[model samples]
Target: MTDLKPRKMDFGFDDADVPFLWNPENPAWSSMSNAVSFLAVGFEKMIVKLIRQAKPLMTDPAVAEEAVAFMRQEGHHSTAHRQHVAALIRRYPGLQNTLDAVIGEYDLLTEATSINYRLAYTADLEATFTPVFKLMLDNEETLFRPGDDRVASLFLWHFVEEVEHRSSALILYKAVVGSELYRMRMAPSVFAHVLKVIRIACAGFNQHVPLGERKVDALSMFARHRAKQRVLTFFAPYLSKGPMPRAFDGLPIGEQLTALKGAALSQTPGHDPAHENLPVLADEWFRRYDAGDDCTRWYTAEPAASGANR
Candidate 1:
């Protein structure tokens, strides 16, 4: 009875000319989300392998079922994101190197880390998605609606499915590893690695993607990078990356702070993702999908009439 069913989606990323600045109105957000596409391919690939290895350790039948469903969902996500990244690489061939570096980081983690540690890593990261994705989805009017439909729809589908199975990773971790303290203790290192991978992808974007196309510093998603760039602008202008802008600058500060607080709280010892405030769009997206509204072209497709149900 696991509700974590995997939904396969093809966003037509193969159609020509997938721009790096997918969301022209929010170039910084475009850059950040593109980096996420790169990150997802590698991270989810690791998840597939991690789940396979951890499968034997799962004792309860329900936990095993949840783990398999979670693995399938993550597998679909990785495939879809690869299509997105492949389109980007086709446009900017040097992005191949960036993709390789990102995947290599995860490959190394799988080889170097223990199963318990990897479980902790997955649990820690997955716990934050509901809050972070909610912030993005809640403001989809600006963040997603104004973007290229294919890319936006791809993310919309992915985020909703993520919400659907928000607790699976932690559930598997608790079942197999059975240590909340260990997960909490490993949060710092886990997040450090996550940020490091994102930094690598963003740095590659800056080096490979032209400034005119990217529109802002690729590393602008990182607050520390932005602060350093600000200092460098006055002292050593040439050393700085291009102008640093935030992806969420247009979003209300209070909402951004709330999401930040939620993300921080997610790493605590006993946080439960099921209790977190969800994005309104998640329910809407599900309603639309169940109503056959063609979520792969979310913006272009007509929504079902009001009061419509599956």
Candidate 2:
């Protein structure tokens, strides 16, 4: 993993003209993903604030700077997702109301919950999402093959950064609470809540797709099966009190950031997020992203329609 400061590369989600079911071949995947984007808008904001709250507690300047960089990346993420969601609202009409309610729910939680609880929630959620993103990265070609490029690129970029900053919350947790046991204890509740939110989001997304399209088919069925296996592989160890295996070491660095517990930060005595040189694939991708090259065509601008509805 590279230790460079996070850069805010806005992928212009506003101008993109994407269908409601961007992945025409797999509306289920598209719906679930849309739900995630809806969650991102508010959830990321809460995470950014939570990270900033831990700034004073961070003694290492490098970690502190990473926190700041993480905030910027998350801020841009929220902005891009918010724009995409607004477009969805325009296309689906009723989506705005559903998402508004969800954001409002987060608002209430933020207001009533203690900071430590919020931080714990953020950390656990990050841990939960780390493996999920790894799965997506692992199966990108199959899942995204028929999806809209703009939407695919948006999520790809988001997941890449998700891998990039996988350790930020853990580092912050150590700085503030200094207890892995607390995190372990909090895991069940956090995972339960995360699942509930995803269910709600999927329900919202499902409403927008036609019933015929929502039916299960060979491709979607296979996708779901693979997705389940990846989830179990990532979480079974922790849940069963067994050894955690590093199943994602060979993935792209962007997806490998949280492969193990998390890439350790330089702020931590022996661990450095930038310890190993990045792989050629990731190093080149970041270079293109930084330079605003056409390699990011899917994200930099609106992409053409994905042929037709399935």
Candidate 3:
């Protein structure tokens, strides 16, 4: 069984200062990416709650155990993003108000919704995010190669773990309430909600960017257009053809981590999450991280320079 237990990965965000556009070279991409992190701060708590609600319904011990691990990881993810959101609001003048409004709406949804709806939404969103992360990881060089080390490391760590446990929610959801009709029905709304939040957050991020960088931002936006396309491609099969029987039959955690680098690239039919591969640097980052090297340097292109400055 996959050891779904979450690792105590304290990336030390409390002390680090980060730039508003951490990926300074590509403000557009930075805005979209940061917006996702921003959303996670609030929504991941909902993920944990939904997973917890579903875990009790899981009869399979393996699925139940993985749910426990998923809950821990999601809790850690939410805490990290909450820390980043605080720092982000400090950096950008109006972001807090925007975030507060979003959180307020989210709180209302959580209060009014059933556990089934929440679980289905969480599962769909997890599936959605996994592919987007894959695209970012695959194109890490041109996209994120030049960025603030602390900020980049924060995101890299998050995405690495995201790929690691991408299937947890879906597996539990299926085991609890395996309804193809319900899954298909909820997917569109889930993706729509996710896109709405991203759009709002990205708009705020762009508004804060300097006018001089708008042209560069526009070009970067065009370059990342493929990411949006990949999102559709990733979910299209499930939406149209129905969710795969083994879609959530994910590999063990050990195999999943080992397969991530390649999985990001191909994601062969039978083996997902495990079948995909990450970008060269990202793969190496995980290698160092797994090996217990000072992999925090994975955040920056120049480890020595980053260390000296720190």
Candidate closer to the true structure by TM-score (higher is better), 2 or 3: 3
**TM-score-based ranking, best first?**
1, 3, 2
lDDT of 2 at 183: 63
Clashing pairs in 2: none
- Give the alpha carbon lDDT tens digit for every residue of 221-268 in model 3: 332444544465587733221111111122245534544544333222
What is the Cα-based TM-score of model 3?
A: 0.73
Model 2: CA > 4 A from native:
1-4, 212-284, 295-310
TM-score (all chains, Cα) for each model? 0.96, 0.71, 0.73
The alpha-carbon deviation from the true structure for residue 187 of candidate 3, after best TM-score superposition, in angstroms, is 1.3
Q: Please report the TM-score between candidate 1 and the true structure.
A: 0.96
Q: Which ten residues in a row have the lowest lDDT in candidate 3?
A: 240-249
Q: lDDT tens string, model 2, 1-310?
A: 2264555555555676667667766555666677778889878878777776668877888778767777888888888788778888877777777787667767776788767777777766765445566556666665565677767777877777776777776666666776666666666776666655665655555465444543421122233534654577577733221222222223466654544334222222333332433333334445555554543344334322432111
Report how far off residue 284 is in candidate 2 (Å).
4.9
Better of 1 and 2 by lDDT: 1
How do the candidates rank by lDDT, highest first? 1, 3, 2
| Regions more than 4 Å wrong, model 3 | 206-283, 299-310
Residue pairs clashing in model 1 are none
Minimal lDDT window, size 10, model 1: 301-310
